[model samples]
Target: MMAYYARRKLPTSCLCRVSELRRQFTSASPLFFQGTSSVLSNRVPSSAPEGTRLTGCNVFKNKDEPLALADEEYPDWLWEILDPEAQQKKLDADPERKAKREWRARMRRKIKTDNFLKTMS
Candidate 1:
């Protein structure tokens, strides 16, 4: 006797559609509703607990003064890698910067970029 095979039908609804339906039905009541902030306040506590220090060193440790040479100092920072390229491209692409081409403007941009680069590391 020859064996016969049958293929199962694919689901009509996607995972997201099923999830949406489930969410709608489950949260139909006021207690479970997402928009009812007062009812849900007891279940969810906002903000970190007291005496919780933020991760990483504080940038304002040296008052409000910026670092003199951020690029030279912190070359490996994430902001340094991403920010400088974008800022350089913006400065290069701007028609006003090109037209002015003043040393002061270029210096200002460079300083700002370097200061940003130094801040994250």
Candidate 2:
């Protein structure tokens, strides 16, 4: 019980100990009783509701910035731009990506040739 008080801080007028809240946070349920049964439970804090830090947390709460968030039409989310069939077509179009294919072939052949061999060795 003392350990729980250490982990949880609830904003309530009652003289509830920290341990009670800490026990609630660790509960597996998404919902829990916050205040004393008499005080009535309401309101979740706006800051870090996920119970984690906002910056450098690695958990991407906002999917926009990483995925073209600046533009609504080209948002970084793949689902926003292409449906399943379109994604498949994009994959199928790889063979027609001539410039890249030619570049790769050129690179492979050039690896054993003079221009690359002299520079590498």
lDDT, residue 38, model 1:
29
Candidate 1: clashing residue pairs, number: 0
Cα RMSD, each candidate = 26.2, 20.6
Query: What TM-score fits each model?
Result: 0.19, 0.20
The local distance difference test score of model 2 is: 0.38
Global lDDT scores for all candidate models: 0.41, 0.38
Model 2 poorest 10 in a row by lDDT = 38-47
Candidate maximizing TM-score? 2
**Clashing residue pairs, candidate 2?**
5-18, 5-19, 67-76, 68-76
TM-score, model 2 to reference = 0.20
Clashing pairs in 1: none
Per-residue lDDT for 82-109 in model 1, tens only?
A: 2333346666889688667677778999
Candidate 1 — what's its lDDT? Answer: 0.41
Error of 2 at 107 (Å): 3.1
